[model samples]
Target: MRAMAYESYGGSDVLKEMRLPLPKVAPGEVLVKVECAGVNPVDWKIMAGGLDALMDVVHPVVPGWDVAGTVVRLGIDVPEFAEGDEVMAYARKDYVHGGTFAEYVSVPVRALARKPASLGWEQAAGLPLAGLTAYQLLTRLDTGPTDTVLVHGAAGGVGSLGVQIARSLGARVIGTASPHNHERLRGMGCEPVEYGDGLTERVRALAPDGVSVVADFVGGVLDVTLAVLRDGGRHASIADHSVLGSGGQWMWVRPSAADLTELARLADTGALTVPVLRTFPLHELPEAFELSRSGGAAGKIVVRP
Candidate 1:
């Protein structure tokens, strides 16, 4: 199988296409024939060694976590799925070695969820990791109908999904983004607040009493989040750990079949949409990395094998 792998921690320059053997499925896992792989900011961050201290890395690493594919073979004792099942997952392992940026990937049954029939290969590929991050963050903060929620980095992969999820929960959402992306946010039922000077005032202009819940997807906004959060309100960050000391939770997404199943249900009902901004062939992963690093995309990037 031809796949992308990086032998060392570096930038896109290190990624290379190679002919590798199909991964053997372990018990409780399934081998998936990759249809599409989602490119995330974390993909490149991990490639750059940004997560060196937090997670162990193995050389010749395949860098991707979000995958949409078909099960080709089932490992021993894996009764949840069989060959030919269409599935998707946030397939991160305890260590970085094999991954979804390949022709085939071995995924754990615990992390598997049936792909939404309503979503295409690329869109389904985009959902797992980013969608789970947004879903977990909102639910952890206890978002509900009576609340007015604020989403930082509203137009990116996670924030875009965050706004839709909040809306589905009946909460009014205010999202921070550039003026150019405001129209997209509005389409998702989010009130767009430009993120720069006067950002707090802009959000306050809409919420007045300050938002009841704050979900931060982008880092470096701790001060801004605090300013517009109502006293005693809930807040959390996926990017910033400082929130832990400030009466807020610092979150990391966990892969759960149950959570991904709920998100799949939302997509099937037309309550959620994963807008795919671009697609690249599997061998062109380095180019995909460059696009994700540019920080200009307002939607998810995908790769088809």
Candidate 2:
């Protein structure tokens, strides 16, 4: 198998294509022939050793967590799926190694879900990490039809999905993005607001009583969140862990087959969608990592193997 790996933590420059042995499938896991791998900011961050204190990294680390592929073999006691099944997973393990950036990855059965039939391979690959983050945040906030939800960084990967999921839950969504992305957010059933000076005022103008939930994908917006949230309103952030001490949840997405299945259902029913900003071949992972680090892409970056 060929994989993009870095023996030491650094930048995109450290990533290189190398031939490696296929991963050994453990009990309750499945080996998947990779079709596409989704690249997230965390991928580049991990490559740069940003998460050194939180998780252990094995040398020659393969750096990707989101994948859409086909099962080639099932590990012992895995009765839910068989060979040749189309699947997708947020394939994060307890440690960092043996990831979806390779030609094949071994994913635990608990993290696997059937790929949504309505999405293409690239789009399905883009869904797991971003979609799961959005879904989990909204779920933790207890979003409902009666709520007005505000989404920060609404045009980016996770924020874009958050807007759609909130809408699907019957909540009225207010999303912040640049002027160019306002029309796109509007198309996703959100009232778009530009993020900058007077952000609170802009949000207040839309929902005078203040929003019932605030989901912040962008960091350093704690003041904005506090300004626009109603009393006792729920709030959460994946980027800002400090929110935990301030009466808001600081969330990290966990792999869940059930939640991924709900996202697939939403996709199949046209209620949710994954947007792909660009695609790169497996060997061009360095370019993909650089693009993801730039944070300028309008949607998820995908690597096709």
The candidate that achieves the highest lDDT relative to the unseen native structure: 2
lDDT (tens digit, per residue) of candidate 1 on 39-107: 999899999999999999888898899999999999999988989999999999899989999999999
Worst 10 residues of 2 by lDDT: 288-297
What lDDT score goes with residue 232 in model 2? 83
Model 1 CA lDDT for position 213: 96
List model 2 lDDT by residue over 15-124, tens digit each: 98999999999999999999999999899899899999999989899999999999999899999999999999999999998899999999999899999999999999
Alpha-carbon shift of residue 124 in model 2 (angstroms): 0.3
Give candidates' CA RMSD values in order.
0.9, 0.6
Model 1 superposed RMSD (Cα): 0.9
